[model samples]
Target: MERTESNGPVTVPALPSLEPIRLVDRHGRRTAEPVVPSPDHDTLMALLRGMVIGRRFDRQASALARQGGLAVYPSSYGQEACQVAGALALAEQDWLFPTYRDSVALLTRGVDPIEVLTLLRGDWHSGYDPRPHRCAPQCTPLASNASHAVGLTYAARRKGEETAALVLMGDGATSEGDAHEAYNFAAVWNAPVVFLVQNNGWAISVPVEKQTRAPTLAHKAVGYGMPGYHVDGNDAAAVYAVVSRALAEARSGGGPVLIEARTYRLDPHTNSDAPQRYRRDAEVAYWRDRDPVSRLEALLRAEGAAGDADLARFADEAERVAADVRKRLAEADDPDPEDLFAHVYASIPPSLAHQRADLRDELREG
Candidate 1:
């Protein structure tokens, strides 16, 4: 499809700029492509291990929230591949701006899962420092972080820095004005940022059909003079390949690329949501059958990537990681109340200072 913007007409060819690479299907069928080589046995094993660890972390967070250990919890259960692949695909220099649902991706990318939990537990302003990790705290406002990412990219490019930015959001987030505005600015200014949208079929309770009339979210990239590609989010390898190529292209001076990952959110939107209230059991069942981890496992087994003993060892390793994570979190220090006051203002204004003093006085009196 061709789209005409302010500059001129931009045409989208019949095929995607990056070819669709798939190793396995929902039904467990193998593809004919020259298998872009799975991560070496050990690497693939680590990825699988990471996936399990991520899921276990999600489970623990949910359980903690239910037990009143946290104020809220957003689960990244089914969207693991999209998060993990995109995060892992980035270069060390690239920046990541993620929404609340990207903890799994952040963890897979080396951001400690315990730190992420600390933020979710309402104990910190951010999970970790942005300078060291090149990752920002999770943005709660849908699609708003895209603009922040675009601004960072613009600044980096202005300073002649060769770094790219990757921002993630949901399909529903695409409907927000900031999302389109960010894209337009990124395109016009030639910012090096990639928008990765995980279209999990629903934006909360609203179905994708209601989010927009567009056939696919990726097609929206045409309006901004960038290439867009749609890929099976369940296929981690394929997601990794496409995103890695897009990141490379962006870093090489190409402008932004929008990637729409076709996947399903296998869990409720959050701990407070009840999927049964609005979604059907059969529909959820259908997606469960297409679960990404199981599909990838099938491919690995069919290809004889690992034997039963190897699988046992990998499983044990994942368990060990999960246990260690639990222990670390158990020892995680609670956030200090004074930390909030200290960071509220580098140099507090008189009016704010008075309010803080009043609050402290009230606390002391009570």
Candidate 2:
């Protein structure tokens, strides 16, 4: 853990910290692993690739939104490690409830890349089916997904299914009343679910300092009779280990775990907002310098696990994937307006039925 010899605010290195596991320091140094061994070359490399691909995809989505190809996109640039690590920790049969900013997690859970893009393009219902993929649609209404996750887990328990339901949301979500209610349900029933809050320090420019006065987001779990763990969201290995342990506890009927992954959002909340309106230039530069991709790359290079050629290949693959997304998105159709009314109920009510008929008539006449 090297220190920056400056009078400025000292940045904490990733190593020798128990609370927040940092296998790779921000300066591209590895922290000593006395008890747990470091992840092998292949595993670490795969995690790095996932983060790279996710960051590239997020950037591409933002660009597409700007180019009028996407309706809106919530970029998940800096939070890739948290998303990928948490989702990858789960078993294939486990359920996932993700937010709009959780593309990295969904992708890690074996979701088809193009299918997610189509959902963002407003071309489908349920994104990809949850029945087969074990991953739910991207829940947009903040902490509402927490309730759904608890319900799903309860159903699974009733069915004697050996699975856990993991739900992802932002720190801003914790302030919602729905989140609290969902926590209550999970604690009372001892449902197999893990509530993962990616504390990215800002909710569309509303900094975490203003979001809540809680000492730590993880501490909130104690009120719900669940244990909480805080992990470094920028460190993929740490994120994986923490989330994986939580998943195991949940699967073994130890109730829910609330994991607050401390990280920073390296981009604006969306393509439309200017982050500069609220945050400082120095803060942005500080986090950008500690790029998650670079940290992993340095570790890989030092271990002789990756060479220049490997890095180049990774960049090339990211570019190819981004290009294909754009090409396919251009040709994708906009979602049908009527499709929205179709999924809300088992059968349409009389009022909505009449409205649908009127909508159809208007479309035909137009």
Candidate 3:
């Protein structure tokens, strides 16, 4: 046993396997371990299609922000595998709690592309209802959604439901209080939830080095008495494999899990950010080469799973998705500025009613 001597005592170091689990290498070749056989060829093709669409959607959203169609946008350019895997691993009855950067995840969950962007388009709230889709709003605050997820899972279990919840957050969220609180609650209560942390290198401009000194985010799970998975975020198949297994265990009353997907943030944190100030071109180039979409495409070609025409159809569908998003956004009815006043309270107070009436009068006069 390896031991480190402290001034007061000697402590044995843990030799847990910290290497990230990867199904595909950087060159898109399969790993030595046997592949998880559940997701067949058609599933692989579907994953590829979702990833391509996500990439296209990310690009379109960023372009929209640049062109002033959106107020702000977070581009999940290189983290599509993590997003798609988290979304797809859930059953129809399961819930998803996502962050603002998780719009791509919502899209993978069959959310309308335009509906997912409505909040970014400067709407007062997320345009879609949460109950119907079993998704929480795209939260902007760090790690707040994690707490919400735990609460939802707890409530579901109290009702004897077999449902589980998947919580998605970036590496930065791990450092927040809400994250630890949620993790503690989930572990102690044995809540049926999967916490998927997309370790995308940087949280805004703060690199992971400045975030924590932990061996890996997944190691945090050991402290809480739950299994943690360290996986290659760029490997779509790997993410799907690990997340699906975790979700199954959670649904079966196994305690919660923490999954840290090792990935990179290929673009700026948001449209308003200047990533060049904090990171170098060479670093970005390194991650760009290990792109998820490229890796999956290479895998597809290697396996002869999707030929030219099949690939072409997926591409065409991706383009249609992009076009439809643009059109829906262009044709979207402008939000009524006064609609903000209506949503704040179930029953309007007299003072607020007076204020609303005054605003209505002013708008009518103008």
Cα-based RMSD of the predictions, in order? 3.1, 8.3, 4.5
**Can you tell me which runs of candidate 3 are displaced by over 4 Å?**
1-16, 34-38, 357-366
Clashing pairs in 2: none
- Which candidate has the highest TM-score of all? 3
For all predicted structures, in order, the TM-scores are 0.88, 0.87, 0.92
- Write down the lDDT of every candidate, Cα atoms only: 0.80, 0.82, 0.87
Give lDDT tens digits, candidate 3, residues 203-233: 8888898999889998888777677888888
Better of 1 and 3 by lDDT: 3
Weakest ten-residue segment in model 2 by summed lDDT = 9-18
- Candidate 2, residues 87-192, lDDT tens digits: the string is 7778878998999888878877878777776667777755687777788889888899999999999999899987898899999999999999999999879899
How far off is residue 334 in model 3, in Å?
1.6
Sorted by TM-score (best first), the order is: 3, 1, 2
Candidate 2, lDDT over the whole model:
0.82
TM-score of 2: 0.87
